[model samples]
Target: MFARLIRPLGLCLILALPALVFRLSGIESDPLILLAVFGTGVVSASFVLAWAAEAAQVDISGGLAIAILAVIAVLPEYAVDLYFAFTAGSRPEYVAYAAANMTGSNRLLLGLGWSLVVLIALAVAKRRTGKSIRALTLDSGHRVELGFLAIASVIAFAIPVSAQIHVALGVGLLAFFGFYLWKVSRGDTEEPDLVGPAATIGALPRRQRRVLVVSLFIGSALVILACAEPFADALIETGAQLGIDEFLLVQWLAPLASEAPEFIIAILFALRGNGAAAIGMLISAKVNQWTLLVGSLPVAYLLGGGGVALHLDGRQVEEFLLTATQTLLGIAALLALRFPRWAAWTLLGLFAVQFVFPGQEARYVLSGVYAALALGAFVYHRRHLLPTLAAPFQDHPDEQAAKAAEQESRTAP
Candidate 1:
């Protein structure tokens, strides 16, 4: 077991080495070099985080671990984005950077990350079974996530329509997030069937396993905190030097780096034929990003001496509209608790269209298309709407089982 652990563990450390040296050395480096060093470090640490999260289910409560691990992506991205928001209080120009990072990460999680999980899971299923499964069914218990995500998605449209992120709005979003954690905690615990490095770590004795998990979580978070700022700055500077739009770079590249862990971890689960867990994790991530991450931006700005609201310009407003609409479409797609191939392709295709037509007009057009499609989807799954709304507050199957067992035991003569 010790020998088996060496390769995966060593690779993560090695990948992180250059960034650690660069960060500690304090020697000024080229923007491109900094991007590579810090980017690699983030990716490497993300892998470690992935392993720790998978192994965490053994130590943490079952459904609760998913909720906690979903925030794994939030740590670095929030650090980078909040830096921009906090700075925007004084600089003001940094407000656009904050918006770009938030919008980009949200869109990327649903577009690329969610689609890839489904597509790859289908491909793996074809090889294993000699037939492709077109739709991946989610566990019924996951309605808790879908339910909260749906509420968040509906609430998200207010931001673009208002062209502002107010403290009240942020608090509202945070309320939903709080309820999400509450629902997850109320669910009964179950042991996850883990594999790969996570399995190796899970095999450890209880105390040792816990110590290792805590160590990895702390170590990776520190590495991420140290690297996120440098990585973001490097990407922006590199974009300027290369004559690329810094908005595009910050929107896409920064998120690509910070979102790496969640994406990689989801892909791993998908490859293992656990498509439900894979996509479910991404959905949880989207929920947290939409709620916790988005909600925190204005609060951070205010703390940095900005006013009570984070205002968005016209372009940023359009971007938020596009992101919110896309989120609504995503919720509609999963209203039936099944992700189909056509929906996967539709999301990926529309997301790719953004790069081809990068203009304010295109954003409005895409938002319209997304909104229409989402409307259709909701209509088709209309029956599930009320149940989805109530799902978070309802008892989970495991919880019901536990309750019934306890009741019967107490009534025994």
Candidate 2:
């Protein structure tokens, strides 16, 4: 009994440590130490959040459960970026950090997170099923997510054109997210296939399971609320102290810290030969980040007394354009409900080029390249694109297959 309790207890301790330390020591004066403490807290809370989400599937429909999970999984990212956006209201210098963090997190999800999922899945598929995975095939039901993403991506271009995130934009995006949740909530429910610590907690008696899940959710939320401000502020201070470009640090480092847990969890799922679930979760997350996450920024700014819009400067404009273009390319690549290896590599390659040639000229040039490629893909796949966009409203074979897969996993010993 003691041995069985160890793993779950360890996870609880891991989830608790950072919050305990933060309460005891408060924010450290040393930026590096502060970063380490709060960052670790965020990562640990992320794990708890992930497990709680999976456990939730036992009680909710698969699509809605995953959607909720995606939102919760990204809470850390939201906390950090929203902090920057809200802070930017009064301190205009902080405006760039808000945009930097948002664009970087969005780009990283596709460039690093999506690509890594396919690569890892391919490797796992070969070993487990003796089948070569040329591409990661998404269920047709994902069309709902991809279609919504396409609409948002197109609207995102308007932000750069206007050089501001207006309240109207926020309203539109939030409306889409609300519709997305409603659509997904009506999807078929399946018994959840729990794994790892989630499985352990889920095996408990019903009342006990419910208690644990609620505890995990409340605990992780508190940890995030306690740590997000310190972590965000420490990152900026650390970059300043190290003489690192604050924009670059906010763009890459902050996201790397906040997004690490999700990346690791998704990769782990792929490695276990559950590539579909891994990619699906990431897809849902992308939608959440693009819609609710982006939409909430201007609202935060407004609440912080920054007026009705969040204004962007030149660099932020370019960043938004680049991020939006990349999103278009990603949707085109997955229009057929497939993520080909070549498409994955293309995303990673283009993302890397930005780091190599960091200038206004390069940003525009790369944006053009992405847009051209996306247009070509859309034109070539025009026939499938319409059907795909209509998929959420119709029954699909892929949805059935996904349901069957879930049933099998859930019943497995």
lDDT tens readout by residue for model 2, 61-139:
6566667777887888999999988987888788899899999999999888998898889888888878787988876
Cα lDDT tens digits, model 1, 333-396, are 8876789899999999999999999998999999999999999988876766667777777774
TM-score of each: 0.92, 0.90
Error of 1 at 19 (Å): 2.0
Which candidate has the highest TM-score of all? 1
Distance from true position, residue 341, model 2, in Å? 1.3
Model 2: worst 10 consecutive residues (lDDT sum): 397-406
TM-score quality measure for candidate 2: 0.90
Residue 248 Cα positional deviation in candidate 1, in Å, after optimal superposition: 0.7
Model 2 global lDDT (CA atoms, 0 to 1):
0.82
Question: Model 1 Cα RMSD, Å?
Answer: 6.0
